[model samples]
Target chain A: METIKNLLMGFSVLLTPENMLYSFGGVLIGQIVGILPGLGSVIAIAVLLPFTYSLDPIPALVAFCGIYYGSQFGGAISSILINAPGTESAVMTTVDGYPMAKKGQAGRALGTAAISSFTGGMAGSILVVLLAGPLVQMIISFAAPEYLALMIFAMACITGMAEKSSQAKSIVAICTGLALGTIGLDVSFGAPRMTFGSLALYEGISFIILAIGVFAMAEVMRNVSNAKHNGLQRIHAMEVVGRVGISLKDWKLIIPTHIRCTLVGFFIGVLPGVGAATATPLCYSLEKKIIGEDNAEWGKGEIRGVAAPESANNSCAMGALMPLLTLGVPGSSSAAIMLTAFMILGIQPGPLLFQNHPDILWALLASFFIGNVMLLVINLPLVRYCVKLVQVPTELLFMSVWILAIVGSYAVGLRVFDVGMICILSVLGVVYGICKIPLAPMLVAILLGDMIEYYLAATIVLCRRSFVNFMSRPIVLLFLVLAVLVIVLPMLRDRFKKNKVQSAVDIIDAPE
Target chain B: MKSRQDLLFEIKVSVFLLVFALVYVILTLVGIDTSGRFLQGNAGLDPTTFPYFIGIVFTGTAFYLLVKSIYQYRLNTEKENTDAAKGIGIPVVEKKPFPFPVKASLVPYIAFIVYIATLRLFGFILDSVLLSIVILFYLNQKNRMRNIIFAIVFPVFVFLLFNKVLDVRLPIGYIFGAKY
Candidate 1:
């Protein structure tokens, strides 16, 4: 009853004309950003962070939430029409989505994707409301030791689970972030650590600057280079013929896939380090495995294939927010930027956020529900127009991105130094990309570094510097054990896989 | 071996990381002040403690990476030799080089630095517009008119949206002597 009342209050807060307009604007921009290849919600949000400084928390947050899931809706459009995913999370959508487009079922593919995304978002929002309260309640009593352990666990998971990067590189990235995080005046000592006498370094590198540099500017650099080499591939979007609405029969086929994927995606999203990119592929594979290759086309315009990933992607995005809102731990890169937004808005998200700022929490949740509906309304009727976003020239698009990144970074503190830092970090980002080093762990570490240090400091004070006393706390010990397991298990699994491959190769050589 | 270039890249990255970690540790030790003590006195952790810990761990991990990469490179070399001696055919995969050479990639960075340095003199709108045009032209030299138009219009739009509407004060050019 209280939850329902709170949700109503949230809806009331969000229903204002101004808030609604901001939400609409955010969604619209997100849709455009999504349609443009090489742009994602992370860059959009990071670039927009400086602008949000002037607005009230609620309107700013509402706009951000709209952009968050709005991109998911936009991503599927490109995936279906141009066979290019607007975001990494939308990659799986191209497999069946493009095939459907090729078969002149582009409308059907897009329709399924939009509806599934809406359903998944709505379902995920409901789950967030239900799950957030319980999760907060459980973690509200945690002390410094447990919080420290939890952060370690999160970092460990990110380092362990990062795709296509070696663990050593991930560790280096995380440490670099931690090192960067320590540049400012210490929270405890009030002494500057590594400012090197620059006042600009006193507050440390702004998260907004780092985010734009790494995510947006670095990406623009890569895209520009690629365009220079290969030239921008002119988009030939498939025609969206016929009605864009999914039929009742199509709905019947999609409903089950939606339910299963939402659940799968939500759970995966709740886990730190795993995100929609992981969830979408998993859901796609799960759908393929369940439907079986013989029964379904799998890759060739299967509606379930379209449904599974789209459903999972949006739900996973919502699921990533669960930890952010409840535990103050970001579950993904997008969530990390949102966490930064919350801080910029002077709102701290965590267990006490419900007690202290229930209005903000519930209103944000309500916006998700509202945003999903708005996305569906905008997506269904305007998809044909939206597909034209693919026709945007890559050179022009990237140039605008570079301008936005520069202006946004400069706007953060009105400092040319910040703008210069963007270039430096962008160069580093390019290096990291070239080396195949995962950036997520570094980002997460940077965001969490201060908090991790605070908790560690508090823990030291609480335990009187006794390691045994620190380990005596059951929750802390459990988290530490889990962290170790998270790190070790992946290593063991990789070793096993390598050994198995080597043995197979040996057998092949012996027989030959 | 096809992976020789990749191994060399990894080795270089590992060595860079190793040097970075060492420098990080040295900086933390020299730069951070630990004279002020907490409630626990000398036993209490200081601002440098976390950074030191991170630096040491980073150094260890980077060292591990360096050793691992060197071993992998040696193994790859041995495999290549074995394959060659056995007259075995190896598939040569064509790897796409990064479109921009090091020097070429540095051009955008240099342009950005110049843009920032000139922002105060030229102002946000003018500098941004000029930067946009240059970048758009660099990206594609053919679409002169379209690029020029877009370069002007978009920055003005962003300027109005940010400076006028959002109420964030963007710099006006000192050359024009325009006051907000």
Candidate 2:
């Protein structure tokens, strides 16, 4: 009854015209940004963050949340129409989505994607309302040691889940990010550590600059390089969207996949440090295995293939808000940026959040449902026009991204030094991109590294200078064990697989 | 099978990381301002302790990576030699250059830097317009009038959106006045 009343109150607050308009605008911009390759929600939110500073907290939160979910809807458009994933989470969509487009079922591919995204997002928002309250109460009992252990578990999971990169490389990237985080003034002691006598480095490298440099700018360099090599092949959208929408038969096939993937993605999101990137691949591989058919058309135009990953990633986006709002731990890179907004708005999201700001919290939760509906309405009808974005010349797109990145970086600090750093970081990003190094771990590390240090320091102080005392805490011990398993399980699994393959080859070679 | 180029790149990255870790370790040891004895009594909460530990761990990981890369390189080379002896050669794949002219693609990045460098002198409107025009020319967008219109219009749009609507302050161009 209490939860129902609170939810009703939240709905009343969110139904206001001003809040709805902001949500509309946010989703609109998010869709546009997500349609453009190299301009993900992380950079979009960062660019629009300053604009939210002067607005009322409720409307601002509503808009930002809209952008977060709306971008997921927009991401599917490019992935299906052009094979370019506007966000990392959308990467898996292109595998099956592009194949669907090639088969002239672009509308079906896009329609299913839209429907699945909405279902996943709605599921996530519902989970947030149900799970976040209890989770916050549970986490409030945690001490510094538990927090330290949780962070370690997060790092381990992320490193293990990294795509297309060796674990060693991922570790190197994360450690390097942590090292960079230590560059500015030491928070514990006001003395600067790695500034190297430069006053500009005193405040530390801005997260916004780093995000733009590696994610946005690096993407531009790669695209330019790709266009230079591939001669800029044009992406032509299908003239007809076959059937224009999903039929009942298609819905029956996808409903189960959506529920399963959403559950998987939501759980992963609740874990700090993991996000949609991890969840999407997990769902993709799981869906493949469960198909149980030798002739299963995965990586082809299988609707379930597109449906699974799209739903998972969208759910993952919603799931991420769980930790961010309740535990003050950002579940993904985009959420990390959102944490900055929460701080800027003088709202620290943790145990006290619900008690002190129940109205804000419930309203934010209610806005998620509104935002998801808005995204569906905007995306389903406009996908055809959105697909036309692929037809825009590659050169024009590159130039626009470059201009946005430069201005976005400048708007953060309004200093030439920030631009200089962007240039340097852009070059670095290009190098990293060329090397095929994973940047997600590094981005996560930068966001969590300081918190790790702070927690470690606090735990140490509480332990009276004896680190061994942490071993006595059961929760900490359990998490430490989980972290170790996360690291070692993949190695064991790989060795097991290799042995199995070798034995099969031996049998074939000897008997044949 | 791993290519020779991939192996070499791995080795190079490992070596670079090892050297970087070493530098980090040295700096943490010497540069941290402890204000007195590095370890006075309770070493747990010391500011330098965490960084020092990280530096050490980084060094160890980098060394491990270096050794692993070297081992993998040798294994790849040996496999290649064995394949040659068996009269089976791996197909040589040539490295492809960037599709667009490298210099052409770099033009926008260079223009962006120039715009930022000259922002104070030219102001936001002039600098943004000039930057947009330069980029449009590089991209080979043939409509000169359209380019000119966009170059002027985009900056004004941003100015009004940021300045008038959002109230976020933007550069007014030093040459236009003294207002920032």
Candidate 3:
């Protein structure tokens, strides 16, 4: 009853004209960014963050939530029309979506994507509301050790989940981010750690600056280099013919896929470091495996293939919000940027946020449902117009991104130094990219680094510097053990796979 | 086995990380100010403790990377030799050179720096407009008229949105000396 009342109040808070307008604007911008290739929600949010500096927390946060999921809707349009995914999460959509377009069933493919995305998002939002309350209540009593252990688990999961070849590089990236986070004045003491006498460094590198540099500027540089090498190709979107509606038969086929993918996407998304990028592919594969290859032609315009990943992609985005809102741990790179946004707005998300700022939390949750509906409305009727965005020139897009990145970084502090730092970090980002180091772990580490240090210090103090006492707490011990398992299991599996491959190769050579 | 280029790149990255970790350690030890009056024993942690720990861990990880890469390189070389000895030749893949030279990638970074340095003198609108034009031209030399129009219009739109509507103050060029 209380949850229902809270949700009702949330809807009331979100229904205001101004808030509605902000939500619409955010969704619209998100859709535009989503339709454009080489631009993602992360960059859009980071670029638009400074603009939100003047707005109230509820509207700003609501707008960001809109953008996060709105892009999922937009991503499908490009994938269906041009065979190019507007966002990384939409990559799987292209397999069946583009083929459907080629077969002149673009409208059907798009309608399925939009509807599935809506269902997934709505389902995920409901799950978040139900899960967030219990999760927060459970963790509210957690102490410093437990929090520290949780952070360690999250970090370990991120590092473990990295590509096998890039695991070591991921660790280096995380360490570098942690080191960078330690630059400012210590929270415990007023002593500056590594400022090196620069007053600007006293506050440490701004999260906004780092985000723009790493995500947006670095991406622009990479895209430019690729364009220079490959030369720019004009985009030609496939025509959307016929009505954009699904038949009852198609709905029957899609409904089951949506339910399964939504559940899978939500659960996977709840885990730290896994987001839609992982969930989409996993859901697609799971759907394929279940249906069997003989039954369904997956890559050749199968509606279930279109339905599965779209559902997972949107739901995973919502699921990623669970950790961010409940545990104050960002589940993905986009969530990490949102964490920074929360901090900038003077709101710290976690258990205490639920108690102190239930209004904001519930309202934000309510906006997701509203945003998902808004996305469906926009995606269904205007998809033809949205597909036109793919026709936008790459040069103009890159230039605009560069402009926004520069202005946004400078607007945060009105500091040229911040702008300069964006360039430096962007160069560093390019280097990290060249070396195959995952940037998501680094970004997450930067956000979590200070908290990790603070919690570690608190844990040490609480335990009286006794390792045994620290390990005595069941929650802390369990999480720490889990963290260890998370790190070790992947490595063992990789080694086993490598050994199996080697043995097979040896057998082949011996026989020959 | 990894290709020769991959091995060399790995070695280079490892060396860079090792050097960075070492420098971080040195800076943490020597640079941080710990003599503040708030430095009491009761405080849970001194400033350097966390950074020092990170530095050490980073150095150790980088060292591991260096050793691992060297070991992988040696294994790759041995594999190549063995293949050659068996009268099997490894295919050499020709790498395509990037259309732009290495230095060309640095152009945007340099332009950004110049834009920032000149922002105070040239003001927000003029500098932004100029920067936008330069970037558009560098990105696509064609569409000169359209790009120029967009370059001017977009920055002005951003300026109005930020300055007039959002109530945020953007930098005004000293040369313009114009009040909004």
- TM-scores of all predicted structures: 0.95, 0.93, 0.96
| Candidate 3 local lDDT, residue B93 | 55
First chain TM-score for all predictions: 0.96, 0.93, 0.96
The prediction achieving the highest lDDT against the true structure is: 3
Candidate 2 on B65-169: residue-level lDDT in tens? 789878888998898899899999877878754323456547656776788788777776788788878766655556688777777887778778777887766
Ranking by TM-score: 3, 1, 2
lDDT of each: 0.86, 0.79, 0.87
For A221-298, candidate 1 gives per-residue lDDT tens digits of 888766666666788888999989878998899999999999999988988988898899999989888888888888
Q: How much is the lDDT of residue B4 in candidate 1?
A: 81
Worst 10 residues of 2 chain A by lDDT: A235-244
Q: Which residue pairs show collisions in model 3?
A: B123-B173
Sorted by lDDT (best first), the order is 3, 1, 2
lDDT by residue (tens digit), candidate 1, B1-180: 338878887899899889988999999988887665432354466677788899999999999989988999999888888988999865575676753456556667777888989888898889988888877777788889999999899989988998888887788888979654
Docking class of 1: medium
In candidate 2, what are the lDDT values of residues A407-448, reduced to their tens digit? Answer: 677777777788778877877667666556677777778778
Q: Measured by C-alpha RMSD in angstroms, how accurate is candidate 3?
A: 2.1
**DockQ of model 1 vs. true complex:** 0.62
